[model samples]
Target: MWNHNYEDELIKCHRFAVGLAKEIDYKNQRLLEMEHKYNETMATVCRLKEEVKSKDTRFLEMKQKYNESSATVKRLMNETDLLHSEMRKTQSINRKPDEALKCKKKELDQQAKELEESKAHNDLERRSFLNDIEKLKEELQAQEEKTDAIENLNSVLLVKEHMINQELQEARKESIESLQNMLTGRSKLGIKRMGEVDWKPFGDICSQKFPGEDWAKISAELCSEWQEKLKNPHWHPFKKVMENDEPQEQIDEGDEDLKELKTKWGEDVYEAVTKALLEMNEVNASGSYAVPEIWNLMEDRRASMKEIIQYIIKQLRAHMRKRKRC
Candidate 1:
């Protein structure tokens, strides 16, 4: 009986041990599965940590970029404010010049209007002055015509006076001749003794003396000879006498032809002819002493007193006309 009780106790003990071993094996398997799941979870946790680090780096870069953008925006706003200030100052500075330009434009317009008015006034005055000048010219022409008519009348009166004086001189000469005839106790017909001189013989002698010379040249030579003779102090044609202890000139009876010519033409006529010949020689040493003819084709005769006066008037009128034209 003790052995059987002991064997039963041993069997119970072995069976309990076997059951514990099976529990142990199940616990080991469950633990292995838990460990594998933990490993996988740990790996997932590491990946998550790396993703968070990368995200943190990107966020820091974005924050730095945002700060730089803000700084740039602030600087741009300062520059815009400064530019606005400068524009306002420029506008203020230009305002005065613009106003001055407007004033200057107004002044130029006023000056232009004044200049146009002055030009119109000048034109009107010039036209009026031209009309006045025309009127003055007409008055001057009429006055000149009146003066010319008066001058012509005066010239005619002068010529008539000269003719009257000539007639008076001729009457005085005739009276002198009559007195000379009575003094000489000769007939009145004997007063004309110049015809007895035979002037043709004297002319023939002059022609012989001066060959190839015309009457004009012979006369010039005679005038030169007389001029030279007159310069000689001792070559007096008249006789000299002592009267009151002073020398007096008297007629030279020895020169019958000269005395006859002097008695026939009067002392005044003889002196006038001599003076005229001397003046002609002095004025024209080489040219003819004869007067030029107004009409070369007309008859060779002296111009009448009326003709001479008419010629002088005509010459004066022609000269006045030429002066007016000029």
Candidate 2:
């Protein structure tokens, strides 16, 4: 019984050992396949690990670039803000000069308008001045013509006076001869003639008293003295007398020649000459009656009052004759 039990135990033990060996063989085979697969998986894992490592290096580079770009953008933004501030200041500074330029332009336009108006006024004044000059020229021409007419009238009168003087001288000589003949006949008949006196003896006595002086010589001296007196500024022959009244005294009352003529030539001759002088002064006092200036062609000096009166009378007669003929 003991042996049988021992055999059974040994058989069981052998079976158990065999089963355990087979199981161990299967496990070993499976373990070899796993090991092959593991070897392939390990190669794949190494390749994947290498790719992950490259990706990590690229990400780090991108992060560094992003930081640098952010810094640059901040700097650019600050420069833009400064530029805007300077532009605003420039616009504020330019405002006043632009307004002043506009005001200066307005003033220049006003000055130009005033200059145009002044030019127009000057043109009008020039035309007016030209018209006045034309009128003055016409007046001067008329005055010249009147002066020429007056000169022509004076020349015609001079010739007629000379002829009349010669005829009067001839008539006076004939009358003086007739009176002397009658006086001689009365004295021969021994008849007393009223107011008859011998003038020849009286003339001889007067000549002897004067001693070498004659009437002609004394008359020339008196004329020269009178001419010098006329040159005085205060010497005026015509007195301002009332109408229809004679002057109280002659202007030449103090003249020595006049006193001598009165004493030598007697009162009648002095009175005749004085009356002629007074008439000439009255007629030639003023206005148209005043004598025109006449030059004596024969004597080469100023014309006497006697010559001027004769010239005026002849001019009047010639004008009257011309009117009658017309």
Local accuracy by lDDT, each model: 0.55, 0.54
After superposition, the stretches of candidate 2 with alpha carbons farther than 4 Å from their true spots are 1-109, 166-326
Q: For residues 173-289, what per-residue lDDT tens digits would candidate 2 score against the true structure? A: 443333333333322121221211223333444455566778445544544443344334354544344555754535475556557767866655455445435533543422122
List TM-score per model, in order: 0.22, 0.25
Q: Give per-candidate clash totals.
A: 0, 0
Q: Write the per-residue lDDT of candidate 1 for residues 217-319, one digit (tens) a residue.
A: 6645544544444444453345679999998656455665456545754454345434433333333333243322222114433334454445446657988
What's every prediction's RMSD, in angstroms? 50.8, 52.6
Q: How many backbone clashes does candidate 1 have?
A: 0
What TM value does model 2 have?
0.25
lDDT of 2 at 174: 47
Give the runs in model 1 whose Cα sits over 4 Å from its true position. Answer: 1-123, 183-326
